[model samples]
Target: MTISLHRSATVLFQGDSITDVGRLVEPDSPLGNGYVRMAAERVLTALPDAGITFVNRGVAGDGVSDLRARWREDALDIQPDVVSVLIGVNDTWRRYCSGVVTSVRAYENDYRTMLAQVRDELDAQLILIEPFLVPVQDEQWAWREDLDPRIQVVRRLAEEFDAELLAADGLLNQAARAVGGAELITGDGVHPTPLGHTVLAEAWTELAGL
Candidate 1:
């Protein structure tokens, strides 16, 4: 689906560490070193005069609730024409690693809340990216039980909100199978490697019609 972007449109990138990729710490690299940067670079290269401005507000360990709490400062205030979000895995990760559980109901609620605000306040086009896992270890497989339901929530929300959907999980998994293993795509089940970021960036640029 084409999520149209006008010249001088502002696009905001939001999510967890996958989107973060050390953006906050690096002064010169506000877009971080992940898909957000890659996608922006690709778009600029193709459309030199598009005048598109890209912003990354993803925090390393944020969950849906965290996004909701910071929405005004990080999202609405930016007044972006389009917002692309890649969240959810951390909600599941906390359950497995830190004993904090974000129930599926809560995940959907918080996410919906943020989207509603965006719709009401900004009227911006939305692109909801699927939170994916490319299991490299045995235990990571168990995360599917928690993460898969959230993925479905993202799909449902995209349809409900008339937003574009990117099946990042499906795309990366296909790549992993094609290349023999997840090692080349993602060193860990959650974070994308350089090649994996390229996959996400290419898909995002195409999806956003950038």
Candidate 2:
């Protein structure tokens, strides 16, 4: 769907490390070096005079709860014309790596709360990106039990909120299978490689009609 933005529109991207992509590490470049940047570049190139501003507030190692905790300051306060979220994978990651499980119910609850806040408080268009995993290792496949439910939650929430939904998981997986293996898609099972980032940016730009 093509989302209409007002003049001088500000687009904000929020999520975990994949979205972060070393934003804090390279403070001079707040947009980081990921799909967020690529998407912004594509949009600006298409509409050079549109006066669109892109902001990335994705924090590495963040979960849904972390987004909830900082939503007011990081998202709402920005008053963006569009808000894009790419989260949930870290929630699954933490469960396996640190035994800190965010149940499906809790994940939905937190996600809904954040979306509700955005709906009530802002006039921004919402883009809810599905948290994806490209399994390069044997054990990463086991994470599907946790991540699949969260992806469904995102889809449901997007429908509920009249938001744009990006089925990134399936799309990226298809890309992985289409040409190269999972390793070419992502170095690990979580973060995207440069090619993977391009795939995401292309999909996002097309979906948003940027």
**Each candidate's TM vs. the true structure?**
0.98, 0.98
Q: What is the C-alpha RMSD of each candidate to the true structure, in Å?
A: 0.8, 0.9
Provide the global lDDT of candidate 1 against the true structure.
Answer: 0.94
Clashes of 1: 0
Candidate 2 pairs with clashing backbones: none
Q: lDDT (CA) for every model shown?
A: 0.94, 0.92
Error in Å for residue 103 of model 2: 0.7
Report the lDDT tens digits of candidate 2 across residue range 1-210.
Answer: 667755699999999989999898998889999999999899889888879899999999999999899999999999988999999999999999999999999999999999988889996799999999989999999999999999999999999999899999999999999977988888897899999999999988987776
lDDT for each residue of candidate 1 in 102-190, tens digit (9 for 90 to 100): 99999999999999999999999999999999999999999999999999999999999999999999999999998888988999888
Clashes of 2: 0
